[model samples]
Target: MIVRNCNRCGAAITFVRTKKGKAMPCDAQAMPYRVAPGGPVNIMKPDGELVRGYWLESGTGDGVGYRPHWASCRTP
Candidate 1:
């Protein structure tokens, strides 16, 4: 599992497995970001304790993403 989040906007994230069977996060949802060495990241756990490791940039042109650049944990 990947611990990803957005620094600009505080948000948790969930990913869906691609049809190709790849566990890739949704760019339109949690935009994967470029990690900086030893830099801090956002949290995504229920208590917001899980440290996020990445953020995917999405909805650049449209200005509105399907799920936005930030999100919470997976749903039921």
Candidate 2:
């Protein structure tokens, strides 16, 4: 199980890698939420505010890459 926190809001978004090497959102809640490679995400701020943001993927193709970037978020 992989857990990622929103960089802007500090909300938790969890994921799990499948046997075929695909990353998927965990079904911890009744409503499933996921952050795609270049998709937008909804985050909750420390002050209990909801915001919109996206995950930015970094690193080159030759090495291991990381996911779930909280670089920026916008007000909805």
Candidate 3:
């Protein structure tokens, strides 16, 4: 992951390249998440895999993952 700051909100982030070779800016911190396909949220795994789910900030989860920076960008 290549670390950088969000251009809109200036939050720390890292780029995760998708299988299609698209680079996505994701939050630097990793959070636990549960698998919920067709859910309302999307998370990027450390290996660049994208999954649909919700953040598990304080409980058990399917795995740990990162959220796209745009989700929390303040200036967007």
Best by TM-score: 3
Q: What is the lDDT of candidate 3?
A: 0.86
Angstrom error of the Cα, residue 5, model 2: value is: 1.0
Candidate 3's residue-wise lDDT over 37-70, tens digit each?
8978999987789999889768768888889888
lDDT of 1 at 75: 40
TM-score of 2: 0.25
**Alpha-carbon lDDT, every model:** 0.38, 0.38, 0.86
Choose the strongest candidate by lDDT.
Answer: 3
lDDT string for model 2 (2-70, tens) is 566644455565554544565544322222233344446553322223334442354322222222233
Assess the local accuracy of residue 10 in candidate 2 as a C-alpha lDDT between 0 and 100.
56
Instruction: List residue ranges in candidate 1 displaced over 4 A.
Output: 1-10, 27-76
Q: Quick one: ranking by lDDT, best first?
A: 3, 1, 2
Candidate 2, clashing residue pairs?
A: none
- What does candidate 3 score on TM? 0.86
In candidate 1, which residue pairs get closer than 3 Å at backbone N, Cα or C atoms, i.e. clash?
Answer: 3-53, 12-71, 31-55, 31-56, 31-57, 32-55, 32-56, 33-55
